[model samples]
Target: MKLPKELVNGSIIFIGITAYFLLMVILGYGNSFYLRLVNIFFVFYGVNRTIQMNVKEGQTDFVSNAVSTMVTSLIGVFLSIIGLVIYSYMQGGDDYVQSLSETFLFGGNPSIFIYSVSLLFEGIASSVIVTMLLMLYWNNRLTAD
Candidate 1:
C-alpha cells in the first residue's frame, strides 16, 4: 500500500527538526530561542509539499488541501513533542525542563509534563497558522479543472 504524501512529508519534517535540534546541542546553542524558531521552516516545507502534491495530482479542493496541510504539520509537531518529552526524561526529567524554561517562553519552574504540554499547545497554534498561510498561497495558484 502506498503512503499518503502528507505522511511522507510529515516524516521529513520530523526528521529535519530532530536533526536540527541535535545539531544545536552539539554546537552548544541548544538553548538559543532564535535558533529554535527555525524549526518552523521545516513545518512550512512539509506542509507546502503536501499541498503541492495534491495540486499535482489534480486534487484542488481548497478545504481538502487545507486539511492535508494541517495534518502534515500536526504530525511533525506531535512527533517532535513526544520526542522532546522522552528526551527530557532521559536528560533529568524536571531538571531538564527547568533548564529549558529558563531560555524558553515558559516561566515559574514548570515540570516536564507542563513544559511538554505548553509546547504542544504552541505547536498546534503554529500548525494552524502555517496551514492557513500556505492554503492562501496555494489557493491563488491552484485552479480547478
Candidate 2:
C-alpha cells in the first residue's frame, strides 16, 4: 500500500529536524536558542512538498490542501515532541528540562510533562500559521474558477 504524501513529507520533516538537532548537539551548539528557529524551514519544506504533490495530482481544493498541510506539520511536531520526551528522560528527566528552560520558553524549572505540553501548544500554533500562509500562497497561485 502506498503511503499518503502527507505522511512521507511529514516524516521528511521529522528526520530533518532530528538530524539538525543532533548535529547541533554534536557541534556543541545545542544550547544556542537562536539556532532552533532554523527548524521551521524543514517544516516549510515538508508542508510545501505536500501542497506541491497535491497540485500535481490536480487536488487543489483550498480546504483539503490546508488540511493536508496541517496534517503534515502536526505529524512532524508530535513526533519531535515525543522524541524530545524520550531524550529528556534519558538525559535526566526534570534536570534536563531545567537545563533547557533557560533557553526555552518555560519560565522556572519545568518537568518533562510541562515542557512537552508547552511545546505541543507552540507547535500547534505554528502549524496553523504555516498552514494558513501556505494555503494563501497556493490559493493565489491556483484559481478555482
Q: Model 2, poorest ten-residue lDDT window?
A: 136-145
Q: Considering summed lDDT, which 10 consecutive residues are worst modelled in model 1?
A: 136-145
Model 1 Cα shift for residue 96 (angstroms)? 0.5
Candidate 1 per-residue C-alpha lDDT over 1-145 given as tens digits, one digit per residue, 9 for 90 to 100: 9998888998999999999999999999999999999999999999999988898898899899988999999999989988998899999999989999999998899998889889999999999999999898888776532
Model 2 error, position 2 (Å): 0.8
The residue-level lDDT of candidate 1 at 56 comes to 85
TM-score leader:
2
lDDT at 19, model 1: 98
- Residue 4 alpha-carbon offset, candidate 1, angstroms: 1.8
Q: How far off is residue 131 in model 2, in Å?
A: 0.6
TM-score of 2: 0.96
Instruction: Please give, for residues 1-145, the per-residue lDDT of candidate 2 as tens digits.
Output: 9998888998999999999999999999999999999999999999999999999999988899999999999999999999999999999999999999998777988899998999999999999999999999889989744
